[model samples]
Target chain A: MVYYISFILIGIGIYGILTQKNLFKFLVSLTIIDTAINIFIISLGYIEGKDVPIYSKYTPVANFVDPLPQALVLTAIVIGVGTLALGASLLVRVYEKYETLEVEEIAVKEARK
Target chain B: MTIATIFVGILMIISAIYAIEAKKMLDSFISLSLLSLLSVFLFVIMKAPDVAITEASVGAGLTTAVLILALRRIGGDEE
Candidate 1:
């Protein structure tokens, strides 16, 4: 069920990336795509009847959930934020110079220059 | 519960669609945050607390800040 939903979200994000004209919308779509991939990774490592991977006094290592995906996702989330900030800053610069957020407009303006 | 997971999944799908399909830049931006929040809930349900915390703080908060700052600079015009 989770995989199905994640695939659907991935498809939606890809569609948005292909069709959206606004620069901000493109960034939003890319974020959505990254999120779907994150969910997919987290779901893949789920084990039935196991507790979270955090160590505890009584918790047996064998009963703990897989921790690798969680660690990867932690880094991925930080990278996602960093990339988002970088993209937004670039968009700000583009908007200042081109005076528009529409992708086609930016391309056309650049083509004419 | 499975029901709650399914519910959050549905919310994620809806939020994703809204974020991409909305007419205005602000609408899409706000919906993107909603999508991120829903994903956080989904992560909690899927037994990934660390990912949920990271997503909640970084995904929902910082991502929105970056987008909004850019939107303000760009004047939030989608056309």
Candidate 2:
């Protein structure tokens, strides 16, 4: 249930991005969708009633949740941030060149030119 | 227990819907921010604080700001 809901949220965001008219809205949707999937992927490693990952002195097999997902999510986040920055810069250039933000309008203007 | 997760789950769904159905780019950005925060909260409830931290910082914070800057530059339809 935990993982499924996260996936559904991600799907919703992706649908929005695909069907949207505004480039800015699509970009925002893409970022949210991206994060949601990362969260979902990380959450998959968690088991109910498990403790943090530590094997130093005490506890047994039931104690630790999988640590790999946490690590992966961290890496995904760094990449997400970099992609968002790059995407935003591209959007800025698109806006400057087109002088309008609506995707349809921009396309029409390009077609005319 | 499952209750907290369920609650966060509902919030996530609502935020996702709002993010999609938003009428304007700014509205979409705000809703997307809300959705990201809800996902972060869900991650925390799932016992993944590391992911929660990054989502809070990158997803909810920096990403939203960047998209908003993009919005300002693009100046969407204004309708």
Candidate 3:
């Protein structure tokens, strides 16, 4: 079920990437894809009836969920943020260069040059 | 727990679609933030408190700020 949701989100993001004309919308789509991938990765480690990976005196050690995916997702979240910041900065530069955020307008401006 | 997970997943999908389709750029931006918040809730429902915290702080908070700043810099007039 979670897998299906992520897949749908990925599809939506791709659709947005392909169809949206605005540069900012393009970045938003990319962010959506990043988030969906993170959800999918985290879902990979989930078990139906397991405790969180944290250990405590009362919790059995063997009952903990997989910790590796959580660790990987921590890195992924940071990377996603970095990617978003980079993309946003690039979009700002693109707007400055092209004088517009619309993809069609930018392409036409490029062709005239 | 399974039911709650499914519910949040559905909401996330809705917000993602709205984020893509909204006419106003700010509306799309808010929808994207809502999607991040729902993901945080879903993370908690999955029993991953640490991931939830990270996502809440970084994904929902920082990402929104970045997007807003970028939007402001670019001017929010969408045609």
Each candidate's chain A: what TM-score? 0.92, 0.86, 0.94
Report how closely model 3 matches the true complex, as a DockQ value: 0.81
Residues A19-106 of candidate 2 have per-residue lDDT tens digits of: 8887767766777677667867877798878876765556555577888989888888889878888988887888789877778899
- How high is each candidate's TM-score? 0.94, 0.87, 0.95
**What is the CAPRI rating of model 3's predicted complex?**
high
Q: lDDT by residue for model 1 over A46-100, one digit each (tens)?
A: 8878888887776755577789999998998999898889999998898789988
Name the weakest run of 10 consecutive residues (lDDT summed) in model 2 chain A: A53-62
Which residue pairs does candidate 1 place in steric collision?
A: none
Q: Candidate 2, clashing residue pairs?
A: none
Off by over 4 Å in 1: A57-61, B76-79
Q: Which 10-residue window of candidate 1 chain A scores lowest in summed lDDT?
A: A56-65
**lDDT tens string, model 3, A42-108?**
8899888888888788685679778899898988898889989999999889988988988899999
* Model 3 error, position B9 (Å): 1.7
Q: Fraction of native Cα contacts kept in each candidate?
A: 0.91, 0.74, 0.75
Tell me which of candidates 1 and 3 scores higher on TM-score. Answer: 3
Ranking by DockQ: 1, 3, 2
